[model samples]
Target: MGLLNRYAETLSELGSFVLPAPLKDMRVGLFNTTLANELALPEHLLQPQTMLDWLHSPVTPLTQQAFAQKYGGHQFGQWNPELGDGRGLLLAEVIDSNAQPHDLHLKGAGPTPYSRHADGRAVLRSTLREYIGAEALHYLGIPSSRSLCLFTSEDTVYRERPETGAMMIRTAPSHIRFGHFEYYFYASQKDKLQRLLDFTIEHHFAECKAATNPYAALLGAVVTRTARLVALWQTHGFVHGVMNTDNMSIHGITFDYGPFAFLDNYEPGAVFNHSDHQGRYAFNQQPGIALWNLNALAHAFSGHCSVDEIKAALSTFEPTFISQYQHLMLSRMGIETNEKEQSLAVMQSWLQILETNNLDYTYCFRQLALADINKAQCPFHDIFVSQENRFKQVTLVDQEKTDAWWESYRKLRLAREEETELLSLNPAVIPRTHLLQQAIELAEKGDFSLSESLLEATSTPYDARWDTHPFSKPPSSSTHTSLSCSS
Candidate 1:
């Protein structure tokens, strides 16, 4: 009972302690050996049989009491007070080799007090997606939660259809979310709210405590990190389908991967979550939605900071996001000029080219990075030749403008390590929706080989070896643009 179990012992008033409802015939489907070694997890916890027994057994010295966090959030722009960890539990906090603490959360563990009328179970299809999605984003250099292991069982769970029950152990700095503050704020629990703020700062943001106003400083830091995170997502064409306050982590990492997608054709208004009929969380709307979520969180700090101070903190969002996005977009194109306006013009023109040609987002960037400026006709040109033939959207005027943009780009100063920088900035492969569906289908048929291969491919997203791999290419024809939120 070291500091690993301190959260359960100290934060008892914030949540209710509960035991996990065991799954039948549970077995480890996938394990992150690298993450385990990085965290220096106990060797006994690495063994499947021992891990399963520990999960099912009564509380022990090592296995502390698990708890369901109580939180409230705004869903689809409507405030909902009755929301919490319906199907998840925070088993315990684990300290890494560097002494950094991370919450070991069990998603789909069992029903808790917040499981309002629904089964507290997760299916393999969704859990696998999350496991892959988290690793993919992490390798892509985005801040996100990471999966430790995936456990599947003979237990059946029903969603839109009968599916195999599964559980995934995801780790993050802390499980605290915007909703945690919101819940206490709205409930008028001032004492609990202050306790939470102090606890969070002490555990995660110790530097803030030295500031004149720690609460305001903490909010400002969160604003900057969230802005940067969303900028990275936009630059890489990733869309987090659900961005409710509860899903927004206070640590500013990507959380709750559900119905998320990467763009195939560069459409600004792409919305992949089937429930988003209004396109509220569409690709182009991500930045705006993020700011909206931040505003909701700001209300919780009203008692700690003045309205003007909170506004000042929130105001950093736009400039930070714009600067970060422009820098990333410029890097992705291999341009290193300090002239912000010109570089931004080039960035916009490049996006226009991709959008007009209806080209695959990842392919265009990878090909451009690999293109030779000395060659009159490089492989990058071939991508356009095929696209220009398929779509009549490219007029003579548009072609001229595109050619002019290319001429300017060719004349611009390149980065010191242009090709390497571009290659690293622009991933050769992403976890595309069609590819994920293929992996899921194979896994459902009792074959985890495809899933394992995908995890491996995604773990090294920038590897040149994947240049010609099937996973690098978007599906020839895709019917999975949008997905249900069942899982």
Candidate 2:
């Protein structure tokens, strides 16, 4: 706990008090001791009792200062002015050996002012999802909040049904969201807005302070980073399921992973969140939705800059996203971006082939790492047929069309020859929803073998051994991949 005071932590100056409601019978079912060690936390602090005491006791030095930061957001493309941290609180910011401060957030601790008539608890099922979900994204070369610890309790909380309660501590560079600025901006609280802006630039966006237009430069920086982050999501087939501005981190990381899913098949328009009946956050719509969120962020800075100036900054989103996406696609194929249009054409054709055949998205790109332009391509074609049987999908591909596609692919590869980089870029395993479900299911039943194994497997997703890890396989028809906001 000494680490908390070591950092140059700037706790919120806002005077809103949102007290934590303690659990009745708090107990830890699982603890991530490995991550704790990585953080250089004292070995004695690894015990469940220490964590439960720190979280459940309101008078602890750390907990006493914890408060729910207020913010507003656009939910599913509609502005909601009354939103904040409903089920969590910022306990403190702990600095590492590198002198970098990271937020130590207590999620699912209890109800706050922002609970808005909800239970303000997370079940063991959903906690597991966040635990592995964050870890998976981290290992995938994506910017994400990493989970530090998780604890389960005796209390049962009701969602669709009564489920055991759990808490998870997530560590991130910062927890600031676009809504944080929007909270003051929309309320016409100009002084508070300036305070928050100054605090943000002084602590997190220090580099922006030297710019001629720090606010505009800060907004532009967020635009570029956010565009690139969403591009990475598209490359890997991730659907965020919810793109509410409140969930969009100003730091450009994949902030909140709720109702999220990887491509089960090659369905670009797939909406994993059943609550998303409108498919607003579908696989293909992520880029556009991210731009929409950035637009909301720019509006938060409206009084500071002209509408035309903001729009000009926003204009960079599309080009930044397009270039990043193209570069990622080319790098994954071991092709250089010598001719952007041609490289994209080949990538598009590859996707078309996979989508047309309903092939496994992760594996299709993965095996391409080992692709050979010289081989007759029989083994490659056989993989798809084998995958069809494994996933219980009927074989369906036009042979003539497939043959033509193969020839085109061969020509593309023969022209631009490269190898090792492709293997590193393509992941052999992902935290498949099916695997997460099984892990959570077994964990809820007092078995953590699967969850622990999955943690290890996903930690090194691009390793060769994962090719046979069983988790590397695609989701079958019976796999429960669909999720909701509750998930």
Candidate 3:
């Protein structure tokens, strides 16, 4: 018997229900089951014995014993009191080998009391994006939800169009959101709010339980983690695209990979989601937006902590984010530096050059990792569209400014001891917006080979040999901005 089955024997068996043939093709595996086996989860969970015998043999209705959670959020900065897990169901929780608890959620299983007049089915395209995106982030060393299984059914789901339906089994340290606290606090449910706070502390922030002001400690931890997470995202050129209050995770993991993109060109104002009219969640604005969301979360804890304490905690975000981002950027640049100002100046200069020249962000940094200062020729300059103009501008700048910086950078690189090591920190390939669009387009036509290959290449993004793949390049002008959120 599987570990899950053995574990399940201890808890009251929740009745099981057939996923319905409509959702079969996309079936993946349970998160804990996959990690427990130390084996890659099968693309689909179709084993009869595992489903029938191990997963509670008989078909049963989903238990409705737990009350659905209610949460309010400032959607695009306007308060909306009616928001919850409208289409999501929390199946159960399981303890992992580390003894940490994880929530197992079945997204698109069915509608709950919170379902607001919409079917709960997820489309295959979105399911695939979430599955691969989450897995990529996890492997990249970013804290994120893990994708256990993806189940596709024959059932058709209607959004803007009729699409094949699917469901995803996602595992997270906690599903509790910033908005969850907002719900109780805004409704003036002090008793319930305190109950939720107590539960959160005991479950997710046990270290803070002994603190005189546990809420303050909790807020500080969240702020610190969130700052680090945003730094990771920025360093990798990832744009979350939609950073609403509800989408922010209390545990600081990156969740909800909706309309996201990796930057091709380093544009500070880059916008990935077509639905975002005001550019509220642009690439450069993410750090500020994260702070805003954290403030919202801090507001929820206002009953237990003073305004000054919360502000102090929130203030840690900028410094923490900058420190983490600088460390990551130095590693990417192959610079070993304890000097913050000098290293930050080099990083900023490179970003400024890339932004000025409209150079591909990933390629520019990857090339700079191999720049040769002695030759009086910077191969890194070749990535720019008009190298002559850029080089001329570089020459006109104070030579001392450039020379001193490069000399310091060279010494820093020598200290690091390996050029390849630094290059490895910056990936040669990313899931570029154009390529993702192509994969989505092909998948919609029932062809998945391109998508599969792209997934394979992105999983091992640092591999230089894979650069020969045509999809690795920025898209032509015709298809660059044509992508839609629906895909």
**Winning model by lDDT:** 1
lDDT of predicted model 2: 0.79
Clashes of each: 0, 0, 17
Model 2: ten consecutive residues of lowest lDDT: 5-14
**C-alpha local distance difference test of each model:** 0.85, 0.79, 0.67
In model 2, how large is the Cα lDDT of residue 150?
Answer: 76
TM-scores of all predicted structures = 0.95, 0.94, 0.83
Rank the models by lDDT, top first.
1, 2, 3
After superposition, the stretches of candidate 2 with alpha carbons farther than 4 Å from their true spots are 1-15, 37-49, 390-395, 478-480
Runs off by more than 4 Å, candidate 3: 1-68, 336-339, 370-375, 385-420, 445-447, 477-487
Which structure is stronger by lDDT: 1 or 3? Answer: 1
* lDDT tens readout by residue for model 2, 266-290: 8888888888889898899999999
On lDDT, who's better, 1 or 2? Answer: 1
Q: lDDT (0-100) at residue 287 of candidate 2? A: 94
List model 3 lDDT by residue over 357-384, tens digit each.
Answer: 5556776676675467445434443445
lDDT of 1: 0.85
lDDT accuracy of residue 16 in candidate 3: 28
